[model samples]
Target: MTMEVQFEKSFYPISSWNQGSQPYLASILFCQGRRTTSLSDIDLFAHFCAAAVPNLAMVESVDDEKIANRLDRVVASIGRKPLRVLVQVNTSGEESKSGVDPSGCVELAKHVKLGCPNLEFSGLMTIGMLDYTSTPENFKTLSRCRTEVCQALGITEEQCELSMGMSADFELAIEMGSTNVRIGSTIFGPREYPKKEAN
Candidate 1:
């Protein structure tokens, strides 16, 4: 059996890589799709990939209130294929964000455990703060959340992967015990932001 692991909320760049490398590869499909990702969307995506490639490993993203029902429904629909979920915690506490607060991630993780027994609650996922200087603190906050979640769930720290790093601040994340890092710029160069027109 092929074991696959994925980095969460990788944006389009990471998704692009997974699209190219399927079957026995860990593919991360973000929740920020055409609209908010629903259970049906997850079903379609997972089913499509599993059909095309038998050995594919998939980790779907979930945030806040949608975490419970969405995960439950998806796992039931997809059947057993080593499904894992990325619990996105909005460490920045932005209004437009979808994840639970870092302070409350343990409660969220507990809900995930109780509600979606079929899916494996492999780890916690957070998008590092945009401001590089503040990224380390954000990672620490996520670390605290992961600790609480592990304690609540009675899972060993070794079994839990606190996915708290990204293209930015990957080294700090490593220092803080981030098992996975979503590296884009390092591999693909700087992202091209939309150019503002001349005033």
Candidate 2:
């Protein structure tokens, strides 16, 4: 199974400054995939606010209202509105990728807009197959999903940010209209994982 990790928690230990103290650029806290029992939605949202990081919580099979209600409470707590959010879509139809199916993206977006007033409903994001280079088909799938999501939400494509690319094929992704690309490894080099010890 694809591990569902908090973006901030993974990076916080190594960073020099606090979450919101970055002088030059802003950061986003992406909590992708399912919500575990240990971390409730309220806790996650509070962390997002406390860290002052924009959140992109990728919803899988969870009920939309549950997400909306949690967001509402978060807004109340922060006394702020319009939190940036992304609806992750499984454009590749890969079981390994963590996101809602393409068919369900529009409905989820709609729910986020109509049901979750606190969320800004920024756009859509997806993680394609790692082995495969970003292909035209993959781009097309995301484009279609974005179009549908915008239409369902009565918004335009320009308003929806398409975050679909990584260091591997960001060039093609840019040509295909990816507003955001994840290029950490390309700039920082490959991450070193700790080796396992024998039991």
Candidate 3:
């Protein structure tokens, strides 16, 4: 398609490589946004478990211990194939946000790490100010959460990821220490290109 998809991180969404991840599913390939209003979380997990190609890797919005325990139980029921999870943080302190308060991130990370053997505490994520440009402080807040999550769990920062950023401000997010980003529409959707010369 001659489109440019740019980013520097462990995960990259390149337009040229669209629909090319199926071959690499055996590796730890995480698909975000499994939750929907129509289906409960457990129901969604069940479907993923029952899928012919069940590569349900990481979930981004685990905000509390209750959810962590519930998901842990589900993962246990399906043998030892563990689910990687990210503890969502409400960095901007928005009342409308779905994640746990930033103050509670460590406790949640600990619960997911020590209490839930069936689930891996992959990292932290946040949906900062709903705009084209997110506040840099929001990114810093997530990085701080990562610091706390790592210290409390005795794990290195690399072990705990920071999944913050989307298409618009992903570069800035990365500059502020975002490891993973969600860039779906920017990659799969239309792109602007210069017109070709007349033949």
RMSD for all candidates, in order, please: 10.0, 10.6, 11.9
State the weakest 10-residue window (summed lDDT) of model 3: 20-29
Among the numbered candidates, top lDDT falls to 3
Q: Estimate TM-scores for all models.
A: 0.65, 0.66, 0.68
Whichever of 1 and 2 has more lDDT, that candidate is: 2
Candidate 2 residue-wise lDDT, 1-199, digit = tens:
1111233225433233222221111113233544546434423321121112334333222224456567656765777656766677777777876677887888888887887777777777777777765466777898999888888878878788776666576556665776655544543457678999999
After superposition, candidate 3 runs with Cα above 4 Å error: 1-55, 132-134, 190-199
CA error at residue 89 for candidate 3, angstroms: 0.3
TM accuracy, model 3: 0.68
Give the C-alpha miss distance for residue 141 in model 2, angstroms.
0.7
Q: 25-138 in candidate 1: lDDT tens per residue?
A: 122332232323322333323311111222234342456646456656666777765456657788777776557777777877777777777566767777755667678777
Name the best candidate (by TM-score).
3
Q: Which sections of candidate 2 miss by over 4 Å? A: 1-65
* 85-164: candidate 3 lDDT, tens digit per residue: 88888888889887889999998898888999988888888878986444688998899888888889999887777777
List per-prediction Cα lDDT, in the order shown.
Answer: 0.56, 0.58, 0.65
Model 2 collision count? 0
